[model samples]
Target: MNPLHVDLGVTGSVLDVVRAPAGVLSTPSPPVDPTAPEVVQLAADLVATMRVSPGCVGLAAPQVGVAAQVFCVDVSAHPKTRTSHGTFVLCNAEVVEASRNERAREGCMSVPDLTGDVKRATRLVVRGRVPLTGAEVTVTTDAFEARALQHEIDHCAGLLFLDRVAGAHALHQRQTYL
Candidate 1:
């Protein structure tokens, strides 16, 4: 475990909802260059933050103010998923293939306590390099895993779950953490 500090700067501020550029909603930016140190560090930071978050399974770089194509997800390491497969740290991940067959509720740290329902791919195949060794790997996520990956990827592009909510009125009120 490469130790890291999960630093979420100035929590509780409202996050901006990034809209898809005129022609880029359907096509996302390419993954980060795995050889880059910035990408590696962002992955580390993401892991650090997720480890400390309650029920958090994944995170993206842009959510941390780095617009690079890096993110970290570790569903297995979470004690909540003791019977699950395990944890992983991905850098420069790209969603190669996905099936748009479901819609589910989603939320984000950037967006604070507001939660909303959004449509998403039920399954996804993400290809990227392992942050620890820079080796190439492809991970196929389903169910919650798929949703988590999608949520993080959206962050990389400056998009947030609240932007995709079908019913704006259903959006939850942001509550105080303490």
Candidate 2:
């Protein structure tokens, strides 16, 4: 099912992307609260959001103003993400290990209208639990797909591409990202 339709928030043009601030759960405990129905629904909504948005390879809850550590990604179908097996569900994901000596251009749903060359691992091994079944899944990604996954993971932590920019002119426009 497409989860993009659940109205997580704005499509977030270049202007609105950085305007968003990350949310805090206040409790010392894990904010994910995996058992909450809203958390479940947010995961569902993210899947739909990823499905409907053109060129969106991944999305994080914080990108939509939600503090939960939930995100959705579909790289198999994307023309640029040939290394992906298919769509994936990630919850409380973390980059376990990443290969060095790799760099690639990246984009984001939150930071639309521009792309930038970011230094990232050509390959990565990510560890996380599936939001739906709560099963652990380890995904190994390389090249563009790796960048895409890393990009979304960063969002879960409230970091934007601008934070990675090396220079003011690093941003470049993309006619189409889908």
Candidate 3:
């Protein structure tokens, strides 16, 4: 069964996304109880925020000024998506396995004006707990879904695509928001 399909059974408020240089964005988040009410609400809020943001495939707690290891992802609508699990939230997510390095362009809601070329694993296996039930799940995916997972995981670790870039040469100014 796809663990990403769990429902929080609550309406989520769309929270404002914080920009880069914010202390929360750079500071690593600590793990929280996946079954905690606050964590469940945070997970819902993340999904709500990501849904409202155009071109956003994922959103992490730090992006909304929360320093917790929680995030939501949905790459089903993306053209580049190859193996998606639909929409889901994960707490304390960690990459258990990763292979196939591939460099690709990445954008962030927190860094609205810039996009970076960052190398990420195209194949990955992640272990995390579902938000409401605290059920541990292992997601094995490839292509864009893999990239999205890694991106949000990085946010939980207080790192951005900018940090993964090789240099200034790998950065580009956004001409339009996608």
Candidate 4:
């Protein structure tokens, strides 16, 4: 199901993406209270911003300058997407299980202009609570969706794709990344 449909009726401006030097990107995000009205609004804002950005499947709150465990992901129209769960938002996400490591090219909104090869789990099960309802959610999948989840989870942990690159040779600078 597409969780992006959650509209809090509060208008939220698209937040600017924070870059490398910004402490927001490097600092570990604090867990958001599931029942807080503000966090619910933030989740809606995340979905709104992600929808307007081209070629972006996922966005972490840190990428948008918020140091909290909030993120939105949607693999809907991407050609590489397999087993996509559509758009969804999760607060206070935790990776419960991960297996099957695979190296693949990755890009980030926070670290633009560079796409690096990072090894990530091909299969993952991530658990989190919805911001407004406090309901627990479990996402289990593989392929591009799995990669997207891992990427956002990394952001919550204050790690960038560069941190996972296997030495300087594995990194690449490019104009675009998917």
Highest lDDT against the true fold, candidate: 3
**In order, what lDDT does every prediction score?**
0.63, 0.66, 0.94, 0.85
TM-score of each: 0.71, 0.77, 0.97, 0.92
**lDDT ranking of the models:** 3, 4, 2, 1
lDDT of 1 by residue, 22-120 (tens): 233333446666656555565656666777777667766666555667776766654433222245566666789999667756666666658887888
Better of 1 and 4 by lDDT: 4
**Local accuracy of candidate 4 as per-residue lDDT tens digits, 1-178:** 4443454566766877788978888889999897798888888888888989888999999888888899999998999987888888888898899999999999887777788999999999999987777888888889899999988988988989999999989878877436
- Predict model 3's lDDT versus the native: 0.94
Which regions of candidate 1 fall more than 4 Å away from where they truly are? 1-31, 77-85, 174-178
TM-score of 1: 0.71
**How many residue pairs clash in each candidate at the backbone level?**
1, 7, 0, 0
Query: In model 2, which residue pairs have backbone atoms overlapping below 3 Å?
Result: 2-48, 3-47, 3-48, 3-49, 4-48, 4-49, 55-178
Model 4 scores worst on lDDT over the 10 consecutive residues at: 1-10
Q: Cα deviation of 105 in candidate 2 (Å)?
A: 1.9
True-structure RMSD, every candidate: 6.7, 6.3, 1.2, 2.3
In angstroms, the error of model 1 at 39 is: 2.8
